[model samples]
Target: LRRKRSSVLRNPPPLTTATILSKTYYNVNSHQPESLDWFNVLVAQTIAQFRSDAQHDDAILRSLNNVLNGPQIPDFLDEIEITEISLGEDFPIFSNCRVIPVEEDGIGGGAGAAMGEGGRLQARMDVDLSDFITLAVETKLILNYPKPRVAILPVALSVSVVRFSGTLSISFIPSSPPTPSPTTLAFSFLDDYRLDLSIRSLVGSRSRLQDVPKIAQLVEQRLHSWFDERCVEPRFQQIVMPSLWPRKKNTRGGDDEDVGHDRR
Candidate 1:
């Protein structure tokens, strides 16, 4: 086994001091920072479309169920099931958009403010959503820390988004060569962003418990921890933006049932 492992463990190649590029962009037209007013109009239209779909289709709901029912349920928890989901009837209002230049290593995948040339442009906007988007779940809490199945407690929880107000920043990064990657879009929320949740919990069986304050507290904490770990300030997500190149999916009127719409 050691010999087999060693066979595949050859020495790694040495690193280059600096990456060499195959292409660089130089243009006569200056890269002007956008006001994002028109962009906001476009975004609002897109979100309206999404809400329309949610009202008629369960595709988004299914996706939520799949994501919430994570494969790695904790040992103390039996199964985490999403019993209900509400995408909400209201829309998010985006405003106060402006462009700023920052270094590439700052929060949201960029450095601090840039002085002159060595900086990237990013768009920051304020988003406010005061909708009742929610998810309700059912699960069993297993008391198996010191012993095996000493007792099984049922837990039903529902969390509602009372409000969310945030500063959202979006930045674009071009593909660099040597190993070419697609131009990517990245975005993240600032630390000052706020999220308000209303959580309700029911525990026990035969004689089921309802609205236990501690359970609600714990669930809210866990949800915040989960959100912070992945998307809050200093963290960001980069994804290849969908090709703006016109396609049948963008066709007016429907000959379409496109799972690719799920990409959003």
Candidate 2:
């Protein structure tokens, strides 16, 4: 009976990163000038959502702290710190995004599961772009650029049977012009630049793996909304600018002469 109860009591496994990646797709035009800003906004929004939702779930916060404090990225461990967190467009850069607990749910759960015991928790995160850039440069994952374009990189999440924790890292690169078109006067746009989102967990813990799918979904939805509101609609209006109207190309002399003779 104990074995059967254990089996029955076990919660459904959380989603995995691979599975989440396969199902999500971004239709935004990443090659455009505004793509970088849009990407940054999306990343910021995602980190904010995670931090906000994680509040009222103490277990998740504790788990997140453990992962941040662990040896996952020893090079960056000292550089990590949390500062003021808020929603909206005031702060454009996120340095070190992390999760922390403010309260406890009576029921026991890790990163992904719904809170138990009817208790709630709260979470907050901080970001400092300069420090993040230093760490990325030291790690050789990024290089110096004249004007770095915004980038969102994935971080690993650590989880166990009773605790969950994780860290988020972001990078930036200089924005570049859209790739040139092959044919004259024919326009082709670039879309769907992949965001490198990675989640890692400690031994014997699978907190983020289970929640990855749902987290991916949430991220996709939020980003899609942000792009549509800020980038897509405005750009669509600008694309039809009067300056880009079709021009009539002059034909050869023979064609003009032939038309004149036919008119006579």
Candidate 3:
């Protein structure tokens, strides 16, 4: 009796990535969300949390201050001290969505629910982060007209960014067997995100210091690259994919071959 039970257990039902893919998209089509509002809210809250958390982190604050104010002296520039940097209050606003359908071959070609067998979503949004910056700088005196020994001055720099937007492509596939409980879902990013950055500022630390505008431009470029690497890329690769599609245990017993067909 033990031998028979063991044999029965050994030949447990087979499950494959293909099976999971089918069930995942099929269920997604069935349980289609009424609105993408939740996603919008999620993004907004995430940005807010990131800002709040970053502000609280002493290391981050100090590091940023150092970067802006540190003793990196260039030609005609003596020192630049960034006193404050206020991140904008803007949140991610959901603009549009495009639905994609993936086939059993793991190819996404068709559009809308007609190809709901393997449904994917492409969501787009805009992010505006106009950083308000305060700078104190000491410049090299080109002319001999010095009223005081120290030439330190206050500078208000406004890096007014119009927008930074990107499109997020998501693919939902299945996990686990088709049981009484709801089917678990896994997902991946189908495409890369490209963020556009725009900056407008009237920055002049001193009438003689012409490099302040250039410095602002440098800061803008640095910010764009930094966000692309640290924030956007990691958000998709590390956070979104892992959070949505957690690794599941292999439930199969023996042979890769199924005991029976994978019923959709």
Candidate 4:
């Protein structure tokens, strides 16, 4: 049960990241009355949809199952039985998300925000919520006997991902020739996270051979490794600008192109 829980939480489906990326874009200068509010609303909407899916999405559950079955482990643990249910309560909730415009000296990544100083904007977002998860598991242990011993346990994991603070950089500059649009900003997550886990009493003699603290340590390591590899480890994500600017018309009677792209 512990191993199964680790598999699901430690290595979540790629779709989860994709979902977040798809929902973070907005145009601030649009004529709509709620243009400025659109970013926050969209972020909230993304969280809500993710929470719902974690609770009841069949496809997501199946994906988790596949991930579990795909891993190769020890012989002591033969068969694994995992529970099917929504991780409803474990979903993240946003407290506040705000975007502030500011001028920065440089923008990281190949993103040409630092080439010339036209304009730069800095944005920040934060999330606060109780991240709780529960799973039921059963495994068969082979003890050199005709009949294998079966062990059952319920696992409860509590991860407090409080205050997810991150910053984004955006830059815009005028161009003389047609170039690719610099209409996107890049951002990444930082290392502010906490997690906890509790395993219910074991039910078989084989349970005595299992070390609970060791399992917990493994979970902790997995969590930290994931953060180091994906979040806190200096990386940037590209976000497209919401508003579209007029493209520079072709002077030689060629196809019109975006002025921003010309500069790049």
Q: Could you say which candidate leads in TM-score?
A: 1
Between candidates 1 and 4, which one is better according to lDDT? 1
Which pairs clash (backbone N, Cα, C closer than 3 Å) in model 4?
55-86, 177-262, 178-262, 179-261, 179-262, 180-261
Per-model TM-score on C-alpha atoms: 0.68, 0.18, 0.43, 0.48
Q: Which prediction has the highest lDDT against the true structure? A: 1
> Please, what are the lDDT tens digits per residue for candidate 2 over residues 1-264?
657786677776544433333454321223121224555689777867765775656665455446545676534223233221222223234222222222232111122233233222211223223111111110111222344423222233221111112212111111122533211211111123222222222211235322345534554465455444533311211121122223233223544444333321
Off-target runs (Cα >4 Å) in candidate 4 are 1-57, 71-79, 90-108, 117-121, 135-137, 140-185, 195-211, 237-264
RMSD of each: 11.3, 28.6, 12.8, 17.2
Clashes of each: 7, 23, 0, 6
For each candidate in the order shown, give its overall lDDT on alpha carbons.
Answer: 0.71, 0.31, 0.46, 0.46
| Colliding residue pairs in candidate 3 | none
Q: What TM-score would you give candidate 1 relative to the actual structure? A: 0.68
lDDT for each residue of candidate 1 in 35-92, tens digit (9 for 90 to 100): 5567557877887788787889878877876776678666888767888887786667
lDDT of 3 by residue, 147-242 (tens): 433343334444544454455444442322343332222323333544444433333354643335565677678776666554452233322112
Summing lDDT over every window of 10 consecutive residues in candidate 1, give the lowest-scoring window.
15-24
After superposition, the stretches of candidate 3 with alpha carbons farther than 4 Å from their true spots are 1-18, 25-34, 46-60, 66-80, 95-160, 170-220, 227-236, 239-264
Tell me how far the alpha carbon of residue 216 in candidate 4 is from the true structure, in angstroms, after superposition. 0.9
Residue 155 miss distance in model 3 (angstroms): 8.3
Which residue segments of model 1 deviate by more than 4 Å? Answer: 1-45, 55-58, 107-116, 177-182, 206-210, 243-264
